[model samples]
Target: NGFKLKEGRFKLDIRKKFFTLRVVRYWNRLPREVVAAPSLEAFKARLDEALGNLV
Candidate 1:
């Protein structure tokens, strides 16, 4: 149902029979960043957007 990244400090929840996934990041820090209602393709798009934003 879910997977986590130790270094990046992010968690992903992929549910069955659902068109959306959830992403939770920065759990160890205050005011954790959580994102939901993201489709698989939209998730990838967000990743690309983040990379571009960092550039």
Candidate 2:
């Protein structure tokens, strides 16, 4: 998984268990980002990693 700034938004490529999910969330509206995961730990880890890369 990787992230980069493109155009004017943060582009994220997150993968787990062989599946990849692409997400585009604006930096200004990060608080509104919704991420669904199978477990609380997974959700937190993924979200942290994704947001970490953006920063």
Candidate 3:
């Protein structure tokens, strides 16, 4: 599975903060295991477990 998403070119700095762009940026930073989770529920569980360690 592809682990990265292509970011769209932006003409203005503000465009980089658009929802789609922001989401893409965040998504790209996720671990490969999290991004490659086999199901939505599994993804959420894995992501939650991963993020919990930061607190």
Question: Tens digit of lDDT per residue, candidate 1, span 20-45?
Answer: 22232332221211223257676567
Highest-scoring model, TM-score: 3
- Writing each residue's lDDT as its tens digit, candidate 3 over 1-55 gives 2688899997899988788888887788788888999999999998998788668
Choose the strongest candidate by lDDT: 3
Question: Which is superior by TM-score, 2 or 3?
Answer: 3
Candidate 3: C-alpha RMSD after superposition: 1.9
Ranked by lDDT, top first: 3, 2, 1
Instruction: List runs of model 2 lying over 4 Å from the truth.
Output: 1-34
Error of 3 at 34 (Å): 0.6
- Give per-residue CA lDDT, model 2, range 1-55, as digits (tens): 1333243323443332222222333432334332445678876887787778778
- Which of the two, 1 or 2, has more TM-score? 2
lDDT score at residue 32, model 3, on the 0-100 scale: 82
Once fitted onto the true fold, the runs of candidate 3 whose alpha carbons sit more than 4 angstroms away are none
List the pairs of residues colliding in candidate 2. Answer: none
Q: What TM-score, computed on C-alpha atoms, does each candidate reach?
A: 0.35, 0.37, 0.75
Candidate ranking (TM-score, best to worst): 3, 2, 1
Model 1 residue 38 CA deviation (Å) reads: 1.9
